[model samples]
Target: MTDQSTPLAPRQRISPVSRVAEIVTSSPVVLIASIILLVVVLTALFAPWLVPHDPVRLTPSVRLKPPSETYWLGTDAYGRDLFSRILMGGRVSLVVGVAAAIFAVFFGLILGLFAGYIRWIDAVLMRMVDGLMAIPSILLAIAIVSLWGATIWTVLIAITIPEVPRVVRLVRSLVLSAREEPYVEAAIAAGSSTALIMRRHLVPNTIAPLIIQGTYICASAILTEAILSFLGAGINPSTPSWGNIMAEGRIYFQINPGIVLWPGLVVSVAILSINLLGDAVRDALDPRMAKRGIER
Candidate 1:
């Protein structure tokens, strides 16, 4: 006979704070990177209100002034407040990066969906993707910007086109494998339309990978924009961008290294933070990686 006084065990629950602490301890690098990214993003988003002076407003007498109570990061050769311009430039860099990534991912998703789902078009589209990939992306971007003229929109387009092929290949491969799954085949046997099968079965599988891809694309796009602008082929020089700021500072670098130093640091930190976040996300989303971690 069973003992009359046998007690049932209570279920243990993990609290949100404990879960957060576990994540932070398990991936301290990602936690630090996330904090850095958050601070940068917030500063850029509120730059207009947070800026001490107009980024573009100039004072001839104050040109090239060193850091002071009045001029925090000093004045550029153009006499604009270096601190304010840096803040504003962050806005431009982030905007271009995010916009280019979105354009690339959106077009890539559509083209990949069609190419992978429609067997007849796959060969032609994949070949086109291959040809694009063969060319050095920076050179291709330069050629496009040269023809289109160096405006903000053109820079965004140039950055996006080069990135699309990478996304297309990833999405296409995912769709190809996913479409052959037993569930997908069963859906086909049920007389489901191609659209329904792709929408319901394939697209959902692509989201996690696409999100990680998007972060990398954003980091690359930002770096590309800086390179193009430094080469005088990106957004107009009049605009306050990290690239433009660094480009201008090169001439007066010996006199005021701070000008180049500040903006360059901003770009470096932003890219690093983004890449770290992407790596962390990839580890979290990839089941194989999680399995390996557990095994270790």
Candidate 2:
């Protein structure tokens, strides 16, 4: 007979959604950062409806006006609404950042799987990856933009290329470690196809790290896009990107400091929030971190 006095251990929660929620709410910094990121992303996504005026519409009459009831963030040298431009500029930055991250991660995952599982191709692929990593990302992006012209597509391509090598390195390392695991070895012994083994046994191991890396890549891509625009090698001047906005505002900074300060502030806040969220994700996904927390 079982001992009546002995109580059963509480069941551990295994739901993925609940786990994600617990991780998100465990830290106040993560919660706040997630909220801020959400707001910024939503605002950017609906910029067309939220903007009170045409971001690119020029008006010479009310140029350099300070923040007021008529202009929430004030008017630029061209008399365009600063608030409108900021909102619209966010769309461009977010799009480039997100798209670049997705593209980099997608391509990187494929290349990394092949290189990690197929030993014959590893050396050749890694050599190419190393060569790309040797160049400074910004300079490489600049060169690409210069060659292709400063369109949104070119800028996206430029940012994605520099970021791919980093993701490839990350995924490759994860796959290398995972491929040696018992499950992977068993799969190989069972005559599973190379793709099947990678997809079923190795890919799952890389998901958490890839998620954290993607957030960082998104932040970096945003900053790089801004820098490219500032240097006149990003999107078209007529387009209102955060970088272009600040670049235009620099010439008249003495007249209206808001022009540069506002966009710069937004960019800084967005990047900070993304980075903090990434950190939170990293902590949540790391078993060592959870063990330390439990010990504490």
Candidate 3:
């Protein structure tokens, strides 16, 4: 007989398929969001191939046609295929949103780390952030875009600037809490450089919050882009973006509601999916909630 104190054989490693299945089952919200995101991304990627008609190709004869077997989602005032325009529009909206979020988060992270870690400049940095926060983000974005001109890069830059302050505040808060941990103090006591302490210790603690914030930034960027486009201060009208689609269609909204309806639906779905997934991620990463989840 084996010794009673001896540990049992190592548990069998989970197969890759089983691991994937487990993740899907455990996080249904994430799975749903992932599917929606994948579809939107793929649609944007394959817009040219997926589109039944050239989105920009104007057909005078078909202008304002209602949803039908031929046009599917119908035609806009310029007689551009709504379906194709919707698919192609996603490319600009998603690209600008995702790009702006990435830039905002990156810039914010660096500034936040500096402000939180270096006591000398904390007050100054926080004051600057507060100043930016005091301004209405949308109004500020519109002003920037109006000054810069309605171009893709301008809109991206405009969107990124307003989002940076939010990210900076989030990262700074995390760094403040993490710096007081015993491990961090011990690292300092062991002659670790400030950079090393921040890189190895503080940075790791901010990941969960950063991920959650990034999703929020992404959703906010999308909405902001749409708002700017609607106001004629974002991307050029020639560029197919969801906001532009709705803006152009609103003129003939009474005659052809599908033009605005389809793009609006896509935007709503995308933002909702991201928010749901963000909540799920936040719940999963927070230790306080982990025990409650298991108990349930």
Best by lDDT: 2
Instruction: Give the alpha carbon lDDT tens digit for every residue of 181-200 in model 2.
Output: 88888888899998788778
Ten residues in sequence with the least summed lDDT for candidate 2: 11-20
lDDT of model 1 at position 107: 94
Whole-model lDDT per candidate: 0.90, 0.91, 0.87
Tell me the deviation in Å of residue 11 in model 1: 12
Query: Can you give the lDDT of residue 84 in candidate 2?
Result: 97
The global Cα lDDT (0 to 1) of model 2 is 0.91
Candidate whose TM-score is highest: 2
lDDT of 3 at 64: 94
Cα shift from native, residue 255, model 2 (Å): 1.5
> On residues 1-296, what C-alpha lDDT tens digit does candidate 3 reach at each position?
97779777874544434543444457877688778988998999899899999999989999998889999998999889999999999999999878987899899999999998998788899999999999999999988888988899989998999899999999999999989999999999999998999899999888878878988899889999998988888899998999999999888888888878899999999998878767766766666665554455
What C-alpha lDDT, on a 0 to 100 scale, does residue 270 get in candidate 2?
96
RMSD of each: 3.4, 1.8, 3.0
Question: What's each prediction's TM-score?
Answer: 0.91, 0.94, 0.91
